[model samples]
Target: MPSNDIAPAINETQPSFNLDDYKIIVEGSTSILTPKSEADVFYNPVQQFNRDLSVTCIKAWANLYLNPKQEGKEDIEEPELKKIKIEEKEYIKKFTILEALSATGLRAIRYSKEIPNISKIVANDLLPAAVDTIKRNIEYNKASTNVIPNLANCNAVMYTKEFDCIDLDPYGTVAPFIDAAIQSIKNGGLLLVTCTDLQVLAGQTYPEKCFALYGGSNLMGHDATHESALRLVLGLIKTTAAKYGKYVEPLLSLSIDFYVRVFVRVHNKPIKVKDNMSEQMIGYMCHDCDSIVNQYLGKREERTSKKGKPYIKYGLSKAPTSSTECKVCKSGVQHLVGPMYGGAIHNKDFIKEVLRINKEEHEDNIYKTRKRIEGMLTLAYNELPDTPFYFSPSKLSSILKISVPSLKYIVAGLGSLGYECSLSHAQPSVLKTNADWNTIWYVMKEYVRMKEPNYKVEKLNENATGYRIMTNEDIKLNDSTKSISFEPNDMSYKIEKLRKLKMVRYQENPTRNWGPKAKPN
Candidate 1:
């Protein structure tokens, strides 16, 4: 009965506890029990999206890596579907998960019921009340065999045993648990991490605190700070894992509502770990105009071995990729910004697998945030692999003091000259392109010169960023400027088609004062 999809309904038989003292919550075929007062423990309804995405990703990971079930083995129970692709080779790996801070057991319950081949899940919490709630929910839902309730500090539990997957979704920063989780996870295991303290990770107001926690600096006053937070978290993990001759490869990194979630796989490869410096970088940002540049810590080059075999040679990188004065906008103050993760944040192959899993209609409505997940992953997969960051056409329009050009126009012009342009899930109206600053400035000025000639920069102040940028002779002298077209060619038209689709490409706040809920008092 415990292995069945439908848990026995409450009140079907008498138990020790009074039914009226609590309430029932149903999410993805799993019902959980919570105190009526809610002050006894915490649950945030907004995190339903977080849980939905996690289940899908875990399923994808298992499908890609696990071995097939033996002929005589009994299949693991899953709530809405069969236990993975049974015919595939990846159906048999025992998935051991540690929900390191499962407050009310909702996520743990979902994992038990939804993700297949999960041998055990330690629904861990330091609070006795939370553990008591978990035990009651596990029994009520008939999930005792799949989930093991534990009362202990998260780090204490992680130190004692290894898990195939460790989820560290804590109240605030995930920094304190990073090293422990990395060390305790089995080689090639997965890590699901969430950091709700955006103020500490993304806000410029507390550089000391950000560095203390994540060991990095965020982009100040930039629209893309959410993405910077994602990178900082990944950077912290990459560096921490390297301490034990391990390396982390980011499978999926996302800046969800009010927080950031990243799924990374840890592997023990000393040679791969040696590439850490190349994966990390420093950013120089112009405080006023918001122009930025990055300098990687090291470089990798293709070298031929003694036996004529090709290999990658890794060594030091040159210093100071940017000058103290902003090159594009000469009037701004240059600020040293990051030691952020410089590698590709999303694995294209892994995202393709997640997208394939997302398309399944077995229980589509169960994934409440499925639409958003699809759009975001599509954009992520489209991003140029070498581009480290993004800029919006609005920012460029503001700098030149011209009426904004349509996002399509900017993207088309870049694509005409053979540059790859795509949207970023972090923010709408932003372009992640392979185009240089010169090409960008040329295009914007070209838009003004041909389309909005009425706006003039001649009378502007000499010390303004706009004035300096507009006067740059190189932008004016570029021969490509004369032949550029604002009209979308086939390549640009393709990107625009994706924008036209009926997808939730971006989301607005669902309610006033919507953010992380407070911990139970």
Candidate 2:
């Protein structure tokens, strides 16, 4: 039996009830419900006869509003809920979410049911049946009192009252709804959009089809079909939002197995093109060797370097070029990769606020909520760095000796706090210079302070060969045994163990053989 399957139980109070009496069909499967009124039975042949389709749709809504994931699985697990709580805590009191293509009331029902104190939710669907279903779902879930469902086509913008968040999860491509969705979101509002038409976006088919769906031309000789899809969607969304005098910065974008999801923040103030737009960077990947490089262009740099310039004279800085030759490619790079959405996932202050709200409103099990939030927030803070950037957690873990999940939470937390962050493929420890080391050290220091204030930090010597701890009065040497040649008992065995883990490295002349020493057998 599948994990989600449940055995039917007899109800003595309802003698006429039979599990097979009424078939509730949704997208793909037929579910038998115990005898119920016709109104209670929901059957939609378009949904492929699956009763759980409605439930899955509701789960997607909840995930986006409260606990969104890069992947499109349809279950609202505990991990996802924790993420939602963390988001709610930071962006409280003033946030609004617009369900641009809300079909049936699944998404609205979940939002109203789960998220506490969500100021307002505008749920709109084009079909009358979908609108009725949305209303009915709200009422059935007892969310009607809190949620307001609307009946409209994709022209939801006509009813827009300037929402802080706009979610576009259409049946296929979100292209038709883009213009309206962008116009409706308030300045600084968040937009959550999903695209299910993978074939068009992935560039496996026609260029016109891709353009019609994603609003961007497909590039040749690139395996970035998924990335291209995201960029195309983002470019289209940005263009649409610009028409309304709103500039959108894609804060988070992920291409999951089945679809692509993007979350962008609207900026309505004086464009601040120099500052915000200047930070936008792109990463180019080598088609041959898989080596990647990140390039950042300032607004001024873009303006000054409009036309190619010859070699510069002494004392004058040459204008930076938009395109650079990939060291790995050895051939001229063909693609302009991304201003890929990068940002923190969990904000600390926001999470604290959420906890306060939950405590004030609900008297139920807030402990679990708090714990989950804390864990997620901690992970985000410790692992993730500022965005409009990139950093690979896997590489960071290799250097730091920490798990990828631990780093993910930290990165997510930092992202949620409004910090720009990215994951680089480069190893954190092997960063090119001392400046990089200092930044890492500073980040680690701050993280330690937040996570464990009592933790001690020891600095390595200038030679990078050994380090001494003031707290423990221990001295570690740079030999293979990682021998501690100090007063009292020498813990050479323990020192070597730490060295073998590469947690510590030795500084030497000519070549720096920095790494933990081998442990004694």
Candidate 3:
């Protein structure tokens, strides 16, 4: 651990800069002194939502560990819950947090003041200026008792110290620090990570860089590649954890604009790790038809022992194939991406608790993302089980040469056909569903052909899968089969409830060039 104290002489001898150039600002329940000039230090007022969400998530994470309910039991009595709260307070006094790569120390100070459960926080940065600034802010906020400022390489610090919670909100890919973070967090501790390298993860500008950093290729043309970015990050974390006989249970994973964040509980159980090994998968997504197929990197086999007991056998191998060409696309080979996590991204229970906390406790004025949180969480809660990526209805419409239908109609249509579907929070225009590629295309084809004869269906590429669905005369599917007229009250209720929240799904840029701060030259 680096020393928290800096000599007064050292402070005086430091390069001359305007100390008064910075101003004190308040966020959440804590006050922070931030650099007025971006050149001096980095801070983005837009990430208030991210910080607010972090505070709530940390509280929820602490509550989960400090006040766990007995397995397979009913709700606790009010009195018993009160007793649990008392125990929780006692446990909070010992909880420690490490905010690795804390640029401005704002989040660490907030965690100290806002989160009642946090005890000690090590706010670390490699820059001497940032460390000095954090120390000043800690004193200015009167949070010196809990927030410790350290100047050191974050990877080195994380590799040495273990904390109850570890947060890594790095500027770019978190690949280099992931292994150290996995080793630093305590068993069952929460690891909150943020990666702002969306271009490499989601855009077509750098496929080789994506594969090099994340051990997966990018599906450059996929509409929902943002979701793929989330999976790829999860895959990296899972693969890294498995090497140490550990695994991650993702409590909540989110792909906000320009970045992705995941809150996961890392476990140190070899058995559970072995059991969940097959969750990592390599996906083959086709560009032409938006079809996705996943192949498991690790396969499980069950066999009966001599004593007639069943046991699982594990199979592990290197990444299967890295071909950028898709075999499923009929118009030659299309774009393919991944070798990503095929497991559940968000735990329904954790998201529900986050919602509950936000409703009952989180202050909205400061926690501006509260409505967005509710809206996103609700969407995540209603997402189809086992669905990896979503398809954009608008993208499909463009491809099929048809008008885009109502999202409700598409969701209801899929629901009525015994297929699961929901609106995706990742992209408002995208619909997440278990309906196969051909079936979805079939529904679109039939809907457009019947509703608008002016649309030239014959103009669509015949070699593509959507055209196959359009031209398939052997089997016929109409509006009833398409679920266009089916208006189930429950389905409407779920979507309406989310719509009523009226949350801003994406954050508006507070200023020009608002994004992750540039590293020092």
Candidate 4:
């Protein structure tokens, strides 16, 4: 960390420069000066949502951990529920944040202005000109008191003191700094990580590179591929922390346009860290139907000791829970895909807190992406917490050669059968539901019967997925059977409920070239 004298030196040093020659970019409460079009890479307009979401998550975490009045879902008395069970002396009332890869110090300055009760902010970069620009901007924005600009290696963060929050938002993979952040963070500290190597992380093009970095196999060409990216990063973080007798509680994990961002809290609990064996899973994913079956490494069961106090006991799961072929659509092959993090990625209670904070604190003009944030977070809160992945209605329909059903119709069918359903924030077209493969296939078959009752089933090959489903006798399904009814008459209400939602669920491209910018010379 930078010394106390550095603050006075920064205040006294008059690096003569005029803000008039630079372009002023205002976002939230901080206005940064960047070199015109040439140096536009210094700031990315694509990450406005990233920054806006960060401010809200930090505030919620602070309220949950720093506030004397305990709030949120966790009970205060539970020893395991305590935010940071580190020694009391290590718990600071005010947060000390470090932005390791601060490009133009825009994000650091925003943190200084947006999040309350911050004792110091260290924005480090390797370029001298960048450091000078940070100092000039701090002076211009009147943020010198909290924002400390440093000229050193962005990863030279192995200092003696630990920070309350450590943000790593490098342009690419954060592999080099994962261990350093894991070791340097104070217990119960927040680590904000961004991986922009969407190609590698999503396993879209290079599955080998994905495995090399994340230690998990890649899942390419799937509806949940983006979420698979998020899980891969989380799995890496979880394994790294577990090695140091720690565990990660993911507050929020998002798969944005071209990157994956996660907000995780690292806590020191040797016993709980063992649960990762159970929390992580290997997935059997079907390429054709987009159906996924998770095979957990282990299982955690609640048991009682001799004295009758409840405790968590970790054990192995039954062998070969799934077969080699896709059970839902018998003709499709099941590929063994993952060693991904299988735990609840979002803490619903924390999401609720974030939503509340956004509504109460962040004004509309300052946080321009407020509505999208609300829509996304609301979808996350409603997601089935135990479900490992999601499937697309279109993919399911394509295999059965049936007319595509509206998203509302799919939701209604599943909801009517007592299965919970929600839209995925990662992919708008996918459905995150608790319905089993058998029920889901039945629903599709039922839809096919109602729509194309007299269609020539004999035309399909015997090995085709549609033909297999039409001949299956276990469910009493046949080519012309119409025995299935959509069980109660009340299912139509689900369609109306979804229709009433008037929220901005996804972002359309605002510019022709709206993605990661090239680094400036």
Q: How many backbone clashes does candidate 2 have?
A: 54
- In model 3, the runs with Cα more than 4 Å from the true position are 1-21, 69-93, 301-310, 313-329, 459-469, 472-493, 509-513
Between prediction 3 and prediction 4, which has the larger lDDT? 4
Clashes of 4: 0
Backbone clashes in model 1, listed as residue pairs: 66-90, 68-89
Task: Give lDDT tens digits, candidate 1, residues 1-521.
Answer: 01211122223244557679989887776888887976766877778888988988888777664432235432223223224455655444566888999888889989998887887788889989888888888878888887888888888778777777899999889999998898887767779999999988888699889988888899978877888899999999999999999989999988887899999988877789988998899888888777778889999888999999999889999977688887777644888877889888888977888888888743565787788788888888777766878887898788778777888888888877778888888888888887777677877877887788677787778877788887876564355355777887876787788788888766657678877898565
Model 1: residues with Cα > 4 Å off, grouped in runs: 1-14, 68-91, 476-483, 508-512
User: What number of backbone clashes does candidate 1 have, counting pairs of residues 3 or more apart or in separate chains?
Assistant: 2
lDDT of each: 0.80, 0.43, 0.75, 0.78
Model 3 Cα shift for residue 182 (angstroms): 0.6
TM-score of 4: 0.89
Order the candidate numbers by lDDT, best to worst. Answer: 1, 4, 3, 2
The predictions' CA RMSDs to the true structure, in order, are 5.5, 18.0, 5.5, 4.7
Positional deviation of residue 500's Cα in model 1 after best superposition, in angstroms: 0.5
- lDDT winner among the candidates? 1
Instruction: Show model 2 residue runs off by greater than 4 Å.
Output: 1-97, 118-120, 157-160, 200-236, 249-257, 273-285, 292-326, 338-521
* Residue lDDT tens for model 2, 103-172: 6555555555555545556667766766655655454444545466776664544344566566776656
Whose TM-score is greatest here?
1
